[model samples]
Target: MTATALPRLCVVIPCFNEAANVAPMVARLDATLAGIAWEAIFVDDDSPDGTSVAVRAIAVQDSRIRCLKRIGRRGLASACIEGMLATSAPYLAVIDGDLQHDETLLPRMLEALEGGLAEIVIGSRNIEGGDKQGGLTAARQMISDTGAALANAALPMRVSDPMSGFFALPRDLLEEIAPRLTGTGFKILLDILLSAKRPLRSLEIPYSFRARVAGESKLDAAVLLEFAGLLADKALGGVVPLRFLSFAAVGAIGLLVHLAVLGLLHGLGGVGFNAAQWSATLIAMTVNFLLNNRITYRDRRLRGPALLRGLVLFYLVCGLGAAANIGIANLLLRDGVLAWGLAGAAGAALTVVWNYAVSATLVWRAK
Candidate 1:
């Protein structure tokens, strides 16, 4: 193809158990792209609901509908990656197979690409004309809005809607950042934003997101937890040491519990022994472990024996972290008068770095 020639654009719909919506979804997508040189790829994540079979039938009649079946229980982001890799199209678009994401916005995205307005185009529900179908529940909407706000605040780039799954960008742009994408999660936007080397220009099209017509919605508790972790990863600049902030936050809370235990032991029980410190450490360690599993490293996928191994490695790392904390504490103590105050700050700063480096390299190495 000549450099001036407009390259092919492929639309990818990632579906899991979306068999019932595939036919109508494809029809709607076709209606929107009447004049565009485009093809629709339905990447099925080994759906048991015959989603792949239905798409295959569609493909037989219309060669534009391609289906890819994943080996294991894959997610939306992984499915999108599979579709992009299979096609030679320079531009790739993502929409929901369940018909929740508006396929009618495809033309607007294509128009923006052709106009050289944006490298990536997003369908936003945050704009004035944008809307959501079956309105989001207050709690769900709040969580989404809060997450987006926090992400925009944390990053240098500003996006009106960062959580929306419907968006389009060039295949070459995605290929450049493929190596940095490790964790299997739903937030491909975060993946792209974090891995993007050059400045990213974005366009937002106002559109309403509809409720799924066929399958049960997969937005469960586990997905939300993974979503939070992805947001945190981006917020921390994708550096492992940033996770130490999470560990430090846990440690700070533990210090509170430790002070209370110390008071209870000495003031009420009249005991001067170190038992209080030891007990508080045990309680805090347990709390940190639970939080790390459910929140900090939720997408790491360490389970059973692998999880136990990770825990052991975590403790070893923490031991080294504690030593670093002590070293900083001693340095401050040498300064006298304001020693305790400075020591506390020094210990926190030192441990944060130490913990993040070790945890990212060892405990959550799989991701």
Candidate 2:
């Protein structure tokens, strides 16, 4: 194939359970970019709804459409990073997998980047002629606006819509900032803008955010937490992932659940101390697994038989981790290595790391 015919743009759609939107998005892109040499990549986090399957089916016939199924990991922003890194195209764009962002604006974004008019092109809902009436409800818009305000205050350069997920930039610029990206949440455009060493020339293109015809929206309370965590990560130099912070918070709650269950069984019901202890341990483990599945690993949640299997595996891993915790604590105390407080803290810290690693790699591993 001639150089002119080679694909010059890669569109990354970070997706999760967006099977219904795959074909429609591909069709819309094909119709919208008639002369542009572009390829659409659906970066799926091993969606249980067979989203990757749908994209692969289309990819079999259409070379311009591709699927990048990521296993054993999840996160929309991370998926976008992986998708962008997999492409050799000179220009890259990120759009919502639900087809909420107008596909027609993609050509304009490409034109701005390819024509040397801008280094970054954002599809803004706050810009003039931008359609804010369609996709986002009042409450959602408020949340977005609040996030944008917080992001702008910390950003090196001012941007009207830093919360926007839809944006385009040169592959070279992306490569330069890729190492600095937090890849933690949904606001990748903000991460890039903040990661840049110097100011970026940005252009906002007005486009109506279309309502989804199929599939549920991914926005939720967790998104808010993730966004907060991203800000923290950027501020703290990426010392910790927001998901890990969420996991630790859930663990703290599980400790309360353990105490409550133990108190209820042993104190109120007059159950044997041994019986109550075992019951509370098991119950707390169960509670932690459920919460982690829902909050920490929401995108890669196991379903059907996988869910049951994961629960059993989680119990085993956590149970073993608990045993290790006690053993290490006892060893430290008996050896007079440190005070009881430090020993116990070290033991708990080790257990938390062990549980998180095992749970992610073994229990809730992607199919």
For all predicted structures, in order, the TM-scores are 0.68, 0.82
Highest lDDT among the candidates is held by which one? 2
- State residue 360's C-alpha deviation in candidate 1, in Å: 4.2
Candidate 1, residues 1-367, lDDT tens digits: the string is: 5454343789888888999999998899788888887888898977899899999988999877889887555566777777877888888898878887878888889888878899889988888789853546667777778778876765557788887889998888888887776435776776677567555898888888776557887664555656655666665667753345456666677668767777787668877657766666666665666677655565454689987887788778877887888877887788673468788787867786777767878887743
Which pairs of residues have clashing backbones in candidate 2? none
How well does candidate 1 score on lDDT at residue 60?
97
**Alpha carbon deviation, residue 255, candidate 1 (Å):** 3.7
- Residue 71 lDDT, candidate 1, scale 0-100: 59
The weakest ten consecutive residues by lDDT in model 2 span 1-10
Alpha-carbon runs more than 4 Å astray in model 1: 1-7, 14-37, 40-86, 115-119, 133-135, 147-160, 172-187, 190-203, 213-244, 260-273, 301-354, 357-362
Candidate 1 global TM-score: 0.68
| Model 2 lDDT, residue 177, Cα | 98
Model 2 TM-score relative to the real fold? 0.82
- Per-residue lDDT, model 2, residue 359, is 82
**In model 2, which regions exceed 4 Å deviation?**
1-4, 15-37, 42-75, 241-243, 265-274
True-structure lDDT of candidate 1? 0.76
